[model samples]
Target: MYVLGLGGSNHGFSACLLKDGHLESMIADERITRKKYGVGLGMRLAQGFSRNYCLDMEGICLEEVDKIVGNDLLVPTMYFRLQDKIQLINHHLAHAYSAYYPSGMDECAIIVMDGVGSKRKAGEEYEYESMTLYYAKNGKFDVIKKQYGYNLPGTDYVENSLGIFYAMITDIIGFGEHEEGKTMGLAPYGDKEFYEKIRKYIRYDNHANIEFNSSDIQEMLQLKEDVQAIKNQEEKERICQKIAWAGQQILEEIYVDIARYLQEETQCKNLCIAGGVALNSVANYKIHKKGFYDNIFITPASGDDGTAIGAAYYGYYH
Candidate 1:
């Protein structure tokens, strides 16, 4: 069977064609359209797919595949309709499964953390929160195994996301999106004091499921119109470093704790991780050093785009 995976955020989309469990061809909508995220390029591409291909390897027609998977051709929208032949995988779950399946590990604890996933209702919090845990064992996926999520009450979940937190600090430091890596690089130069202060904003239970208080740093800072008046360029750099460090620190602590907890609970030595946060190389390095698991695997395309692949895999395998 041929399995296809697609992933990305608002700025772009990526698609991977997998046949017999190996990646065959992968393309991004942005590349084809020359648009950063391929915002409106999907329909054009779907039209192209229809004209170009015949007898899609999966016993489905190109028109049918396009109809079902091409509905949400725009970036960041998950409304794609791929003729219902391809199973839809939850964006994050795809990240989780992608990591696990490729790792060749039988039993393992998986953690997928990202800015957001297709939104799920959480009581008064209509917006989605991060899902930090998903465990795979005996060839099945379980989301309830032990998970950590965070959302600020009465606010859009993205508003308080760690991904957004990092992105904002990156911009505040004058780096913009391209400079996010610079912020990450500067993190080692800072102290942990900022992390201590930010910790007050995060609330989580014994399981490490998180919730941010309304008075979190982002909200508190927004209250002051001229936040820059007090925080100059140097201060902003410090803040950026602090934000990077804190985000890294929290993820490491939580992931390690969760790994240990899951390891103990499931007695599994293999671990896999996906999602945007899994892209945190610093945390990945730390997790590697902590030696919580005999092996760890993280998806290379650890974002929403991978959901397309996950959806395909889930459809074919499950």
Candidate 2:
């Protein structure tokens, strides 16, 4: 059976074609359109998900596909071509699946942490998910914990998120999207003591979920604006480096804590991690060194693009 998987189109999208449980092709949207993240489409467009390119690469039309799996909303009327053989996967759950299935483990503990996920209604209001923990065994998953934040819809900047906090610090240090690696590079040069400055403004729940107050929001802006006023270039760079160190250190601490909690709860020795935050090599190394699990798997394409793989697996198996 031919299965078409679509992901991203909102934040770095991609398309994948699966033929009888094998990957035929996977193409990133940015590679096709020359536009980063295929922005401004806002989850609607025929060309957004790169379905045409995916179909063409497989030497078949959309009708040839037996099933369609997706974690995003794009071109609904276009779905009529395939009938109702569609599966919509949840945002964070897609991340977890992307990690666990690729890990090649029979059973594992999964964690998904990112800036935002599909918005869900909470009482009278809606919020996006920031972190989710799962236990995967026997081809099934159980959501053990989830952390939702009041992330302002349509924007990446907001409080109450470690992922967003890192993004904010990256932006404050004069970096843009896809340039977070530069900030991570600066981490080793600065002192770990600076992390206390970042940590003071937030608290955590028993699940290691972060809760940032108004001061945390102000801190990034203050660092951004205040640093420019410095007279010496050395002083300015030092401050930026310090902020980068603090952000990276704080992220590593929480990730380790989460790993500890998962190990304690699941007693599963295999670990799989995904979502945008999993892209941090330094933090991943820290988690590895802490030795909470015997085997650790981190999806190389941990962002939204990797969800395509997860969606296809879901379509084929479930």
Candidate 3:
């Protein structure tokens, strides 16, 4: 059977074709459009992607494809082009499937974390979660837990997002939006004392779910304001680097703690991690070194762009 998968969100937009359980062709919209992060996909781009990649995969006809799958968050938008062919896959389930299947493990614990997933109507503080955990065994999947971050209605900022916190720090350091890697690289040069101050702001529940208080957000903004007013370039760089270090420290600690919790709960030695945050090598390495899992697998395409792979796997198996 030939299956076509599609994914689209604020971070990346992509598509993939799978034939009889093997990848036939996969293409991210950013590669074709030359736009970084590949944020949006209108009907035109969706149709073009399908016609060029999905329909032509190894001479497979679009009509011959058995199923068309889409990320749960993107399927409604995709309905115009795919019509009845499209089926929805949950956001976190897609991420877990993407990581677990690609890891080549028969069983594993999966963690998916990103900025946001699903849509929110007004007055819904937790319309979507920022992170989730799942256990997969022999092609079966079960949700262990999912954590939410809160945001007020009509506000651009989420009060409890590590992704947003990192992105805000990236901007505070004068890096353009989506340039989180620059901050990660600069983190090692930062002062240890500053990192301590930043790490204290993060608190979590017994399930390893994270939340940030209003005071923490205000303090972060104040720090940004302070850094912005610095007169010396060296001083600014020093402070920004410190902030980056602190951010990385918080991220790493939270990831390790969550992984530890999962290991304790599941007793599974194999772990699969996905989402944009999984791209942070520092945290990934720390999680590996913590000895919670005998083997750690992170998908090559850990970001939102790779959700197409997960959507396809969901369609094929589920």
Candidate 4:
């Protein structure tokens, strides 16, 4: 029963090996390639490099593996000779599985939220997943709801996502991309000056209020006052801190709102959370403090790295 899970097709790649349904080893592509998030050229080179590492961890060659699983992204053909040995599932489903299987709970509510995830076709084009909800029982989880981001018409930016809204503010404050943790860390130092202004843009509808949308982002939270041009040392720092605080506040408000709604709807006492946004310790703590669930489990590797674990679990169990 050797199952290998591979994740990080779009961002960072990781491999997780399971022997008889137990994790044997795992490694991320960025760990060996020194490439952050699998960015730039020759992604197959990095993925193949990571594949070898996991193979070595189990003291076995690729052919000896019984099964392999991955998320929505394509697995490099160089890594596996037979496509039949590999299976793929939705990005958010992988995220949910990663949280629930390890939570040691037979049933729980699963939530996945990230800046952007695997694309799905909508109308004439594709839209990326932003948030999702799932319910698990007897070691199997089913997606209950999914939220997608839509183009803001004539702009490259996609709106209607809480995760994107937070990440946007993080980038506007000059943190950029994976530096969203910095935004969360700086939130406490900021006052609620802009909190109300940002709240107006984010709204939701649907079961458990899972439908998240940014009513308007062209204003982009009234970002007309650029933080980059402020020359005053104290003034620049003050404005940035305030921006972080406001975004964090809005993030928690909506996060808890969804949690509360799910608690009432599912009546599930256990909660499992994963995805890039689940990395927010501040918002996570706020959810825990509110006592919406009897027990809550959050993966340490909540980002794409953990999706490998989820893929492996999904493959092994199926």
The candidate scoring highest on lDDT is 4
Ranking by lDDT: 4, 2, 3, 1
Task: Return the candidate ranking by TM-score, descending.
Answer: 3, 4, 2, 1
TM-score of each: 0.76, 0.89, 0.90, 0.90
- CA deviation > 4 Å runs, candidate 1: 9-12, 33-87, 122-127, 145-156, 159-180, 217-227, 230-235
On TM-score, the stronger of 2 and 3 is 3
lDDT at 132, model 2: 89
lDDT of 1 by residue, 1-318 (tens): 655555555544666555566654555555555765455554454443311222343445444432122112224243344445433445666667667776788788887776666566567545554555767887787765423244555443354355555555455445655345676777787668667755665555555455544456455346223435555676755665666676556656765665566666666778888777666787778878888788888877665555555544554465
Q: How high is the CA lDDT of each candidate model?
A: 0.57, 0.78, 0.78, 0.79
Candidate 2 ranges beyond 4 A from true positions: 40-45, 73-86, 152-155
Colliding residue pairs in candidate 4: 160-213, 160-214
For all candidates, the clash counts are: 16, 1, 0, 2
Model 4 accuracy (lDDT, Cα) = 0.79
Tell me the lDDT of model 2 at 53. Answer: 84
| Location of the lowest summed lDDT over 10 successive residues in candidate 2 | 73-82
Model 3, poorest ten-residue lDDT window?
42-51
